[model samples]
Target chain A: MMPTEDIYQPLLNVIEFLGTFAFAISGIRHAAAKRFDWFGGFVCGVAVAIGGGTLRDIMLGVTPFWMTSSIYLICTFMAQMFVIVFARSLKSLDNTWFFFDTLGLALFTVAGLQKTLDCGHAFWVAIIMGTITGSAGGVIRDVLLNNVPVIFQKEIYAMASIIGGLAYWALVELGCDMTISVITAFLLIVAIRILAVKYHISLPVLRGEE
Target chain B: MMPTEDIYQPLLNVIEFLGTFAFAISGIRHAAAKRFDWFGGFVCGVAVAIGGGTLRDIMLGVTPFWMTSSIYLICTFMAQMFVIVFARSLKSLDNTWFFFDTLGLALFTVAGLQKTLDCGHAFWVAIIMGTITGSAGGVIRDVLLNNVPVIFQKEIYAMASIIGGLAYWALVELGCDMTISVITAFLLIVAIRILAVKYHISLPVLRGEE
Candidate 1:
């Protein structure tokens, strides 16, 4: 599949770096919180940073973005070092987790949606890919940590990504500028996630028993 | 991109059915043991039945096998029903778990290795794919149940698949009959797995601390 045009190349690159770093840090911090060792922490960091995109690339029939560049691996390594260095000071900052996770979710959602469209998938498929891109890494991280996936626990996590993808698709359909559409979608996801958490909102459980 | 020749179609079909059923039952039993609800158990069944092959197909740049056939879904459904019907009698039969898991692992490894070779990948890549196909489903199953993946718990699980794959590759290189190569790989994996468990053999753990 083709990448975005040259005009948006630099913007996309920044998103890639920031999103990957945020995700990597989130996983590393989680590893630290759980008292996993250095190598385990690094593995978690890399998994959170690259898992979603790797799945997306495989589905989209492209080489995974991480495999093509050393930058993402370096970002994860830096995240590992950051966690080790800041362990004492960062002991009680749940907000740090929220911020990085939310930011990564928003940015990755946009990137996945745009990449799917670039690969000529329909809007609905792109939206699904965006949600997967946004949440699958966290699922993997939780799995590795032996926790039931938080997203599957009725949180507004993947839903926020889905909502953002829908808004982006609608804006593009309505002839908005590409940058405007991307910004709006990103902000909307962050706002929705924040509001959902602050207000104790969640999807209702689908009970198996009557 | 392309499937195997029609000459091999029926043989592959039987393997797919048996492998899917065995994996589905293995995961369903795990969920039942964990006291998860029916829906949760069903989810695990489907996840284990299809997850490995889905990943393999995605990596091979093919539409996942389950996407093309309804038979796999039916197999999972039947597995779920089998669990419900035999819940009490099956409660203490760990051998049932070993049988299905080992059989599924062996069958899937061979199927994945053959498919990768058909897709024109090198032998080493095929070996990796075989290991993934054999072990990744169990990883997903354990993850869903919030358990450390059994394969990573120093068990000779994925390694058995890799060894089987190497044997298959060597046999093919030695110009053994195709059926002979396939049967040898599948049986070797099963035998290795059984022997490992019987003798308490395991890979050494890599300790995080000195």
Candidate 2:
């Protein structure tokens, strides 16, 4: 039997925590690759972990979720330590990284949708917010790392998030409750992401001036 | 000739408009230097003109200022056209750019301070918000341009904004009216910025990985 708050409020918190940790680890890795110092790495980690949700909350006229709790900050610091301790081994665990990144994306998308709806936003705005929650952190990370955002370079992950958001809406409209809709949407995003990676599927690249 | 709305709301709007135009032009000019296309240049222009205000409003729990009016967006477009038509000559006018940039920095600092106070935040928070409004757009622009932010490299302009905010507070506490305090603070920022540039003053560079 599902736990009380059976609407998955408890489940959402767990997903949010895991997503924060994964994104923080990913950010620290990028900062390390750029040869930033320890302090720089920690800054990057924190930015990636909280940037998306902070932006979403600001736009939603709500206080940033992280500001209400120190757990996200502590999680990022732990991620920084984990990178410092296992910098090389972390790279060798590409499959593990892949799984965590995929999981993070799925969790963030669902959580964003749920929060936006709870805040009384329309389904369209929720979809946009969901995509932003899933991918905007990476955009901020890319900015700090001095690269064009990956979403701009190619649309795979952002597109996946958008589709996941749409899937959630569709399921809801089809009479699935919040829990069923969330689970199905999360799985759909993971499947799309995995399939795209495995089959090398991507949108067309833009050609420059001839 | 003191005006009604004795709080200087009209003056704030004028400063805001001029600041937006200057920042937008600066953004477009940089984008052009990077060989960004017209669309890319416009995007950068909008980011620079409204970026800082957007961030500040978000942090302050208000809807972004730009969403309430299309004037800022239109102004950025005009700035883009201004750049396209005067691309080469614009470089020859460094003194003009300095004037506009300084004016923009000072104006944004005061506006941010005023808005923060209007939102009922503490003076210290207003000071921090002023600094952000004065300088964060350039950080965003630098990120888009793939360079480390100038603020990270040295703290001259941000320091000026901070000093300006403090000056406003001091003047108000000394019994000056709102208009007098605002004008004095704006001039103080401009003076500090000019002096810093003229004297080549900057914080010591951080030496790394020796």
Candidate 3:
């Protein structure tokens, strides 16, 4: 009999590819604003697309997924193309980028939690990894774009991931089915991100000493 | 019998710790210039100190050094304390930060090369990883501070690391004593960085479309 991961691996790959593409678009758009050349834009896209997962894999003591697969690079290149082709139209739709970014964040969080569990980490560790996987790429992208990370600012980004992670941890702890727990966490992340954006909700601004 | 690594491990640890502290100070200083709060400064400091090594370790398929050791964190914290206490005094020493930063870069490049060799990677990979270890942290720090990375600017920062890495690779290929190889590469990095600054040497900047 095939292992459970093998059974689910194809679906996971699809989700991951979509997430990577979206993250790449977000990064590429940011790079465009800075007038990065084609190579710089491509590099920025790839960095944002894979940065979080690479970080997660490192912490989990595994070879990075991108090193073993060409798909991610191809997807990021495709994302760059998409941005260039639709630059004018995409610029008009302010929420379009936000939608894809949130969807990617939700999908990545669940995938990260699963990978952490597979690596035999504790629930708390899994939650942290989940949040990192969802949010760290954006942090890297924002940094590359030369701005304060939106997550660290008055944005509910990382906090949404954290909540989803907590929900996943609780579901697993309460002996829920694995699929049910994953779906619940994924939905929670998506919903939280949407609501936060729609409501203009944000974390409190951190005050510096005067 | 103890392994050879054990014999030299303490010395490596000391070098790594000093590099970490210096890197943290550089990061904290940048964050302070941006008016970041204490927590933000601390996070940036930690990121700059550990970011390059973490990325190298990930690419090298090893657990991140900071994850396994509390010493890096402790060193970063001490750097933070030093910054807070000497804020007024340090503000006057324009070149002191550059000196420590260059020393840390040289030390980290050699240490990173040694670790990659221990992992049985090829010489070229070790050289690239060494360059990443020496330069990537400052890139991350610059990004976090919302500025163009100094490495990508006209500065010869990464070039200095690349030169050092090439020297290390050549020495190893020539079957030079490992200690001599490390020392020679370290000094080369420091000398190159100093000369670059003194002579205003830099790479040609890439021009984007007008």
Candidate 4:
């Protein structure tokens, strides 16, 4: 299943680009923390921003959206620029960046779910795809930077995506318009993520025998 | 291009299964070293064994080979069994495992190249895909384990795949049969990797300004 021509495509593209920029910035921050060179940081950022969508697109049997569009690449470059120019004051800007990152995750989750639904997959598969689109990039970034993936840790990250996906599913089942359902899902994810962080809510750590 | 129906497919399947087994075992060994539980280890092993091929298949806009085949999952299970049953003597079996891992890389590189060529891609693209098939799993494993990727700082790993791909390309250009070219290229990768490890030949560490 592929995206049919849509009059709303241009607006959707804007949302996608915003998400890409924030995700890339998050990736760049991690790479910089690990002292990767400029080129390495840029590559890492691109990987983080586009990795999930690329995987989803491949699974969908379409050419990767990033490969077809220069905008995503340019967004990554801009992410690198943000890191470079704000290097000295980044710690102070953490909250601001975190806001954008959360918004990006929300937007991406909506996009992922809508795309999967458009492909005519079942709800459960759509949930998984939406979660992957929202969180896989961060997992890849953590891995590349030699850190335990945050998703597997105490952060309520992927859970937010799952819950948000269910919310979208429920809305669609009730005959909600596609745009309204998407926005509802997006807001749900953003609100969940923000509240989780603000309240320091976390899943219990798994205990394995030493 | 997709796999044409071939009489020799059984033999190819055998090679692919062998490679998957070895790759899975390599991933399991890493997981064990990190003290991950059996379930964690099994998951890790499966990720390493099929991660590269999955990526390649998706990029080529085909169903991931593992999705249609049970053999790959079975092979990962066998790898876990080998690890569990041989736990006491596994450390001493490192060299034996290394041999299989090298063989896996060689076989996978050949498979990747053939698939890319079948898809009507140019030789350079085939080479890149071949290297990805051989190396991406290890990169993923290293990242998941919070270790620096060996590909970024190791013995002639991806280089061997590149050189082997070049050999295959040259042989085909000179009118060699596809089977012979694949075999020669596979052997070349195996030999180079083994020799590189035996000689401790590593790429120089890149020094970035601290």
Candidate 5:
């Protein structure tokens, strides 16, 4: 039974690495558009990939991951380098970048939910963490760039993460297989996000007077 | 005894408001430098004054203050308008701004430490929260302006908060009067920060590698 569980761990780790790479790439692309130097681009990529998780861990009183493992840092650096080397070619694939970004966002939400559950938190707390994990890196990225969060202004970003987390919770309550539940949650997030973007769905803004 | 405590509460509330005003002014001054619009300047001012404490409260599973009270928002807007009206004169009084910034940092740190202690956290946790409440606002400010945190790179800013926290903790452990301990801690932070800035005392950088 332990060996069976360990088998999936490697797969999860691979998915995590891929998600990090995709997220870092998105950050690098944004930094390039902002005309940042290589060092600035690298920092932005690393911060966007790890900022949310780092804040979560700090709040939970856990040691931050990047302080213990350099793999995340290395991956971000590679992502930045890749963008720098292939800037012109990558510029033509805006849609592809969006796809990767959405995929990474979904994976991050699932990862955050799983981590919070593993830490023995309640479902509501897990859902909140999932949304934070999915959206906070982007929030920090925008803040560091001196802009309002895109989620606060644009498509249904955090709403998708919330819906995915709820779906995960519902499936778990129904005693679905953990793997299937996780995959379903990821799909729900990606699908909702894609649909929202296509249809331009948005949350009602909190009016100043309200 | 109860009546006395209630009487003092009003005084404490006034002090808190004053501190918040000073902090908002510092933020507004910076926003003026950046030439942000009225709304942007107001948002920045409020964020700089309350951002760290809001984060601390959220992490501690408490309601954020500004969400509970509109006074902070109003104060920030007032600060922004005041700065806009007096931008030219204010720009000439750099020393006055620095002094108010130091005073605001000190008072905010004490307020944070007190809140954490009231929440029944450990001394170390209180110290950490105090430092977070004092310095994290400016970190957010710098990040929002697309710059590295001045505290992280420059003079002993965070160090002042930490030292003040330690002083508060030590005084409490020694059974000093709570009000006296709090006031002493605040004064210590202000003095240390001002002296550090005047003397150009700074932390050694971790140089050598990327």
Candidate 6:
């Protein structure tokens, strides 16, 4: 008999797809701005969409997601085409992209935490994995462009994911249903990130003088 | 008695320093070729020397090496200065650099395999860690430069590390002394990599047209 699916599975799948799409669009927009050709844009988009997850899986001794499904590749291609077709209009939709990007961060954090917990890791390890899944893709993107990672220099980025992971762990400890814990974690991350950006709340950097 | 007073411990420390120096020099040379500023070159050199081990430690749930030791930072700076001061002479010593690079690769593979085994990982997992430790820094360098990884396209690069790892395992199974096993494994990796490069024995890529 096929095992019954968990109630949260469908929601998690939706979150994964949304996160992947947002990351792909971000990469495609950057590539377009750099005047990369279509194939180059597509490659960059795909890398942005799956790079963090691939790193996580390799670390965790699992096959990468794209190796199991072509959905990510197709989504990246669509993202590239969308950017190419809507370059001028996209400039006006900056706020919309920001919203989706935060949503993607939240979803990725939750998914990564859940997956790490499922793999029998401790809560601390799960939190680290969550942060890596949420922020490493953007770090890779910025590094490729020869820019300092936004996460390394800016707004409550990894902190939001860590907070979400802690919340998820606390809820699980309190015996909350898995679905409720996941939703609460995801919402917490999105809310904290948006608030941080709105208030210009940033992490302090050490500007050591030589 | 302090462990550092032990003969093998001192030897290990010497090898570690040499390996790190070689790795840093390679990174500085590459950054100079790309015309990166001094700070950029220093950062790249440090990243190249320590990046693979850092990744390995993260995956293995250990604190990263540079976090434990500041000496690596000083070594990288020295390497950058050495490259800057000797750029013309160093440019004429490609063979010398290649020799040290291969030796660094061998030492890194052995260190990775040993660390993974110490962490109680299986043989296959240890072998994977060995390859990651030997090749990942170079891959990161290429990626940041927007080039496809040479390991993925060139001579038996990672394969040499894998062979070394397998040899280590085989020697362990045959009840060889740990020191002898490690030395033999490192020698095998260095010999195989040098031979592959000298003979131009490259791996065949999967042609896209096919």
Q: For each candidate, report its DockQ versus the true two-chain complex.
A: 0.13, 0.13, 0.18, 0.15, 0.08, 0.06
Cα-based lDDT at residue B98, candidate 2? 77
- lDDT for A88 in candidate 1 is 80
Relative to the real complex, the DockQ score for model 1 comes to: 0.13
Per-residue lDDT of model 1, residues A1-210, tens digit only: 124468878876766677788788878877877889999999988888988888787787788888887998998998788788977866576686677668878988888888988887778768867887888888788878767766655578888998899999899999998888988999999999999999988764323211
lDDT tens digits, residue span B86-198, model 5: 76676577686677778778877887888888789999998998888887877776666555677777769889999999998999899998888887998899899988888
Residue B152 of candidate 3: its Cα lDDT?
85
Question: A36-146 in candidate 3: lDDT tens per residue?
Answer: 988888988988898888878878988887899899899999999988888898777657667777888988888788888788776766776788788888787777676
What is residue A10's positional error in candidate 5, in angstroms? 5.5
Docking class for candidate 1: incorrect
Candidate number that wins on lDDT, 1 or 3: 1
Q: What digit string (tens of lDDT, one per residue) describes model 5 on residues A111-171?
A: 8788877766667667767887877787777776666555544557778888999999999
Q: Give the C-alpha lDDT of model 1.
A: 0.81
The residue pairs that clash in candidate 1, if any, are none
Rank order (by DockQ, best first): 3, 4, 1, 2, 5, 6
Q: Candidate 2 lDDT (Cα, whole model)?
A: 0.81
DockQ value of candidate 2: 0.13
- For B88-196, candidate 1 gives per-residue lDDT tens digits of 6664766866776788788889888988989999999999998888788888888787987888886898999999999998999999988888888988999999999
Docking quality of model 5: it rates as incorrect
Query: Is 3 or 5 the stronger prediction by TM-score?
Result: 3
Q: Taking the tens digit of each residue's C-alpha lDDT, what string does model 2 give over A39-148?
A: 55765787788888878887888877775567888899888778887776786776777777788898888788889998899999999998888888988888887867
Off by over 4 Å in 3: A1-114, A121-128, A140-148, A159-210, B1-8, B35-43, B77-90, B93-96, B144-146, B154-156, B169-175, B194-210
**Colliding pairs, model 5:** none
Worst 10 residues of 2 chain B by lDDT: B201-210
Q: List the residue pairs that clash in candidate 4.
A: B1-B119
Assess the local accuracy of residue B210 in candidate 5 as a C-alpha lDDT between 0 and 100: 55
Q: Give candidate 4's fnat, 2 decimals.
A: 0.24
- The Cα local distance difference test for each model comes to 0.81, 0.81, 0.80, 0.80, 0.76, 0.77
Residue A44 miss distance in model 3 (angstroms): 11
